[model samples]
Structure formats: structure tokens, C-alpha cells
Target: MDGEIRTRFKTICVYCGSNSGNRAVFSDAALDLGRELVKRRIDLVYGGGSVGLMGLISQTVHAGGCDVLGIIPSALMPIEQISGETIGEVKKVSDMHERKAEMARRSDAFIALPGGYGTMEELLEMITWSQLGIHDKPVGLLNVDGYYNPLLALFDKGVEEGFIKTSAREIVISAAKANELLEKMELYTPRHDQVASRTSWELSQLGYSKPPI
Candidate 1:
């Protein structure tokens, strides 16, 4: 057994909005992501709540008989908690920072669905972590309806400005479909170890993250 090699991804972390955006495509993408996880037998780790995209995905995955974990800060419960039944296990932490740490700790890969500020912050933080070598797990954007095009442009601009390295920009992988994204992420090899680290100033303000939902 000691010589046995395990599958690289058993559980995936998803960062999404507390509120579902005003687009049917967004909800459809979240549902597709959940269904894909179930089909792959991959569990879920995400912000705890039953409202918005979080609820839609978790519930979809749970209904498909997949294990789902929801982690949320105690204080944010009033705003993020689901009204009816919640799928799988739900963990409540003391604060937002703990919530994020718990989510990151339990996941093997990360995907971002179309969302608002909370989703952006969570997704960006994960990319930053990968950039800093805190973890080399794959981070992906669902990019539904090209919602993340602007964000991608921003990263490119950072590269153009000479602040972000060309290599660092590769930290984020994306796909329009859930299965394709997962497949790409599965093939992802950490290139960080192959290259020198960027300056601390370039990754300044990098530390523990707190999601604002």
C-alpha cells in the first residue's frame, strides 16, 4: 500500500457568489459544475450557505449523492445561511478568515463560478497563494458567458506593466465548460518549482484571506 499512488483530486473547492447573478447562464454553469463533480465522484468544499450560486451547486451535487462540505463564518450566517435543508456537512468558523482557511485546507483544486465581489476576492486570493508557493493546486475560472474576461484582461495588463511575470499569469487556468476545466486542471503541473520566485513586493499584502460575501 505504501507504494500505491492515489488520484490527484478527490475533492474540489469552489468559490462563488452568495447571491446568484441575474443570468440564467450563470446558474446553468454552477449546476453543470456540480453535476460534473458528481459524475467524477469528486466531493465539494465551498462557502457554507444555501442561497445564490452556493446553494444551487451544493444542492445539485448533494442530490446527485456526492459529499458536499460548506464552511462559513459564524457572523456571516445571518446573511449567507440557507433557509431550508443544506447538503452534506456544514462547518461554522469563528470568523471569515477561518472560513477561508478551512475551505482551502480541505480542497484539492479550486474553481470559480460567475459571482460578485466575494467570488472575485476568494478566487484572487487562491491565485495569489499559488503564486506565492503556499499551494500549487489548480485554480480555474468557469468563465460563464465570458464574465471573467475583464479579470483576465487585468492580469494581462499587469503582465504588460512589467509588474507580474509571464509565468505567474499562467497560474490561472480556465474553460467554458466544467468537464473541460476539470480535465485541464487534472493535467496541470506546477511550474513554480521550475522558476525563481517573484519579489516579495510584487506579491505584497499576501497573507491569510477573508472573503466578503
Candidate 2:
């Protein structure tokens, strides 16, 4: 850990499956991401859970001396919790909307690990928020083992079909490995034009004190 490089992000929100995928690579990638965060002295904000990739990454980051925060919807608490051993600081929100909002407000950036509908939903919202100028934070995808290849391609297709603006395609920073993804995200700059002024968006309603300047 000598001469460790400092990261621009103080905390990053990670969206991953509550169920670890069939392959070991997914779990490995999640743990690797956690270690990278610790190395960079960055903390973690994630969906609250005590199983699967969520548990793996959270425990790894917490054990590495970095703060870990888990935000979960009240309805999911019973499903995601394990033996009454949720890690770090757990915040229970009233619903999914509040859960996602809290996660965004607490983190400086985001990373999406290979997951199912819920994970993709969270990732897409962050990207949409960036598109609308709600926040300029980097949104990264840990495309482990090419799991996200199709989704990435679909995004490209959107750009090609005119459904998505060309500039907005750069909103999702992606890489196959945790180290590479973090490196890419650290250098990410908001190149896309915002749909509206951030001030006009009334960000305080989402728990943000102020939008990124």
C-alpha cells in the first residue's frame, strides 16, 4: 500500500446483485473492487444486504478500515438481511425511490457490478441524472467477464438510432477490471451537455445540499 494513489472520489456507490452470479468471477470482481476502494482510501455506499456480492464487497471494505454504508428499502430489509448481521451503518428508507436517492446523495460517484433488474435500474437512474445535469459524478461499470457487453452495446445502439444523444453515451465509464475501471473513472470528466440547469432541478428535494459546481 506504499505510495498509494489518492482518488478523487471520497465515497462511491456500488450497485450489484444481492445474489452472486453463477460464476466465481463476479464475486471475485466485487471483492477486488472493495480492495481497490480501500487502497485509494475511498469509502463505499451500497444496497444493504448480508449475502451475495453486496455482502462480499461491504465486508471487504469495512475490514480494510474504510467506512461502509448500506442503504436498503424497508420492504427489502427482511429479504436482504442475514442472521441479523448487516454490516457497517445501515439506513432503512421508506421505499426504493428514497433508497436510491439516499445512495446518490451520500456518494461522490457510482460503480455498477454485474447484476439483475434492480442493479441495472439503479445504474440507469444515475446515468439519467447525469444526462439531466442533476449531478456530474462519474458513473462506472465493472464489466467483469463481459457480462455487461450486451447492455453496453444496447447503449451504443441507442446512440446510433438517435434515441440517445451521442455526447450522453460517455456517461457510463466502463472497464473489465476494478483497477482499470477506477483508473478510468478517476479521469472521467463530464463532456455531455446537461438538459437543464442544476439549480433549476431543485436537488434539495433529493437530500443533496447543493448540486456539483
Candidate that scores best on TM-score: 2
TM-score of each predicted structure versus truth: 0.86, 0.97
Give candidate 2's total backbone clashes. Answer: 0
What's the CA RMSD of model 1 in angstroms? 6.2
TM-score of model number 1: 0.86
Over the stretch 1-213, how does candidate 2's per-residue lDDT look in tens digits?
774678888999999999999999999999999989999989999998989999999999999989999998899888998986668999989999888888988899999999999999999999999999998999999999999999999999999999998899999999999999999998999999899978889788678676665
Q: What does the lDDT read for residue 46 in candidate 1?
A: 91
22-139 per-residue lDDT for model 1 (tens digits): 8789899999898888778789999988888999999898987779999888788788884677678988888877777678777888999988888889899888878876667899
Which of the numbered candidates is closest to the native, going by highest lDDT? 2
RMSD of each: 6.2, 1.1
Model 1 error, position 151 (Å): 0.4
TM-score of 2: 0.97
Span of 10 residues, lowest total lDDT, candidate 2: 204-213
Worst 10 residues of 1 by lDDT: 204-213
Query: Which RMSD does model 2 reach against the true structure?
Result: 1.1
